[model samples]
Target: MKKFIIAPSVLSANYMNLKNDLTQCLENDINWIHYDVMDYDFVPNLTFGSKILQDITSQIKMNIDIHFMVKVKTKNFTDFFVEYIKANPQMMTMHIESMNAKETKLFIDLCKKNNIKASLAVSPQTPIKKIIKYLPIIDNILVMTVEPGFGGQSFIEHAAGKIGLLRKIIDQNNYKTTIEVDGGINSETSKIVKDYGVDIIVAGSYLFGQKDFAQRAKKLAGGN
Candidate 1:
């Protein structure tokens, strides 16, 4: 069987006891945590900055999957993420819609310089062709099943077709790039994406909203 990772998104985590929640994840054997960074300008909603990310990384031993939903400009890529880079996440993902080709390459190079895995994210409406050229170079690809800004939305059924196409391309090219899907990833949707070749599953409300986090996470991992 292929390896499947369940990365619980911190967006739906309990802020009052954030560390405790994260510790529970680690105890449950789920090591990767999906951290979403949203700038109000890029996604209409505002999320945490590098300082908070640094705080989380400093305390938790879990791998941080930083998804930057903010806009990236060529002039300010480094400046905007200097502190985030210091946090030293396991992987950093940026949206293809946020940057031009030059900026995208610059972001990937920046990740390489810092020894962080670079990944590109595509929104539900954006076609796979937009980032086809990047599949070989990037470490992973994030396919957002719902809109990027908020959580708790239903999974878009049409995104499955996109996942299938991406899987076909990756298999044909023999690329090592992994596919990650976010939003509305409950037991049912998890199975759908897993069949379509998703290696990583990002669950927000579905995981955090439940009392038994480990059980839900195991189900998302394709357990019976």
Candidate 2:
């Protein structure tokens, strides 16, 4: 099994004091930062682009995990995929709901060629079977606990079952793919997510809303 990790989402961070928040998270021993890349076509909201990602990466030593929610057009995705991989990120994820199986495999191959871990992301309504075939090659599986558009949403309880099933498939095949759960993750919901076999927890509002960022990060990581 992979080591547990708590990734604080930058989408919820105070943009005016972004570096300070990231520093505080690191002070708490939290080394993974989750970036949500949204293109208005795939998701209703628009968020960080390469400029913002570049800016953040330039200042931080922590591992970066990008969640891409954009149009599934092959050419466009390939271009964006190349750009994100150039950042030499720890992981880059694409929505299984957005692309066809062939595109998903191609994206994974591209990431591998660039030495970046490729992850498959699924929305709450997407069936687990849609992503199972890619699990053997993917480094991670991002199970969205809420819709992909925005942050500060409630946890969709059924997402737990989806994660459990994916875990079973990974275990049965003896694959090393890590299961990551995102959206609506706070202290209490994270506990439920752990019970469902999530290896990485992505928390946005729950983490950034608090004043004690370090302590909040520690608690989310299951520390004392």
Q: In each prediction, how many residue pairs overlap at the backbone (N, C-alpha, C within less than 3 A)?
A: 0, 0
Candidate lDDT (C-alpha), each: 0.89, 0.85
As a TM-score, model 2 comes out at 0.94
Q: What's each prediction's TM-score?
A: 0.96, 0.94
Stretches of candidate 2 off by over 4 Å are: 1-3, 72-77
Pairs of residues clashing in candidate 1: none
lDDT by residue (57-168, candidate 2, tens digit) is: 8878989999999886555557766666656689999898788767777789888888888898999998888877778888999999999988899999997688888878
Give per-residue CA lDDT, model 1, range 84-187, as digits (tens). 88888999999999988878998899998899999999999999999999999999999999989998999998976688999999999999999999988888
